[model samples]
Target: MPWCSTARLLHLRSGAAQLDRLEKGTTGLGTADALLALDCSAERHHVGTFQVPGDVNDLDFPLPGVRLESTNVIEGDGANGVACITRITTGPGVTDYVTHEQECTYSTFGIHVGQGDRLAFFGEGQNISVHLSDCRNDVGRPGAEITIGLAVSPYRVLTIPKGVAHTLDGLGGVVTRDEPVW
Candidate 1:
């Protein structure tokens, strides 16, 4: 199952998954103790310190026609570590393909896709290698987290597609809905 909300802001702690968009006046949401919001909308994707939870991996994406803007991972008190993202794609008359593994560390790394790109995180792991590729014109199950800024004209409804989910392994925290940024 998947969690869906249209509230301005949404926070998920204790390993929760979500999908929705932030209202015009919202600054987005936050997660502690390792939280992940798939296809979650807000100003950006923010992560905090905590151990990786065992149940925070492998989530399916629920929507299509959504593009991921970027992702960032900040380091905690722990020594240098690594995280990996495997992208799998499928569609009508479309063949399933794998994206070169995407990896990032607490060293502040991220990925950027153009407008209308469909992709998902297949898996996340520690000490993973770095690979980069694009999804061209396909979609797949959700597998990762962070913030996403949509690429469309103004006056358009901001919608987060399904088929994606976010998860933090550890470091549980609180999630707030419709919270002010300033």
Candidate 2:
């Protein structure tokens, strides 16, 4: 069964306005919970799933031969704070793979990547809710949307394909590191 069946049923019975309020967190529901309460089961055509690897080498990359350094934390002896690092190594003929990081203070919506595929890895203790829509058709044309709730841990990766629109909720203080594959 889809994760948001009850939420979908509520949307069908209530209306989009209620869902909108839920999305905006005006309905007293937590932002992440509200996003997960949305109905997107019917529109998950291109939304990918989390790749939880038993070992770093077992990861399935969206693009072949793409290599990335696992998330590593370096502890300081006494005076310095810990540092986290994630590095991307491009393969042959692959010139550039830039990793970007964003720390969300609140729910952010309508994020779209038009150039290339994006691999997003969240920091420790991140509990995020994502709403993804595949907008591969002509501009302004609607496509399938999928809502995913994730408790992000180390070594987990989520792929967002180019031309897909996505939203992140309940990300206060959560840092999201994205590696773009071109």
Candidate 3:
């Protein structure tokens, strides 16, 4: 059974705002080693790392609407299946958003980008940005405030660990899905 089940829409104004919240430590996003043990499969997706060009001030901040789809698994074989699914949709002119998983549960974030839209990941501390494609490609400089471009795909899922504050930039008309595992 799922330990937590909740969902809500996050209307994010800018990446700067999200970064500020993370720096202030008010967002309540974090990571843990115990949670890392739950998802060993994530290691294969860990991939390589790269540095983000320019600074956070160089990008255009767009307003993005993020639909949080957190659902409880009513029935499943183990941790690999789900019997029920939930979805939420938003209107145009809504883009760019940020979110974090709760302390104990790990979340798999999937992003599907629309035309003229791009996505990047910003993690607190030493956490690196990841991109999922045919091969693993990790972007962003460790401990630096930078935005790295993430390719859009249904198969691209970033496993977010506990205690790690993270947010995405340039999610215009993008579909963001969050599946939390405990």
lDDT of each: 0.25, 0.46, 0.30
Per-residue lDDT tens digits of candidate 1, residues 1-182?
22222112322331222222222212244322012223333332223222222333322222343322232333345564333322222433232333332332222222212112233232222222221111112333222233332221111111233322222221112111111111
Compared with the true structure, what per-residue lDDT tens digits does model 2 show for residues 1-182? 11232233222333678667767778664556446435333333443544333444234433222223344444457475344444453622232323224544333334322234344444455566666654443323234555656565545445565544556676665556565554
Task: Tell how far residue 56 is off in model 3, in angstroms.
Answer: 25
**Runs of candidate 1 exceeding 4 Å displacement:** 1-52, 55-57, 60-88, 91-108, 115-182
Evaluation by TM-score, superior candidate among 1 and 3: 3
Model 2 residue runs over 4 Å out of place are 1-86, 89-108, 111-113, 117-124, 138-142
Alpha carbon deviation, residue 143, candidate 2 (Å): 1.5
Q: What global local distance difference test value does model 3 have? A: 0.30
- Let me know the TM-score candidate 3 reaches against the reference structure: 0.26
Count: clashes, candidate 2? 0
Q: Per-residue error at 182 for model 1, in Å?
A: 36
- Best TM-score goes to which candidate? 2
Ordered from best to worst lDDT, the candidate numbers read 2, 3, 1
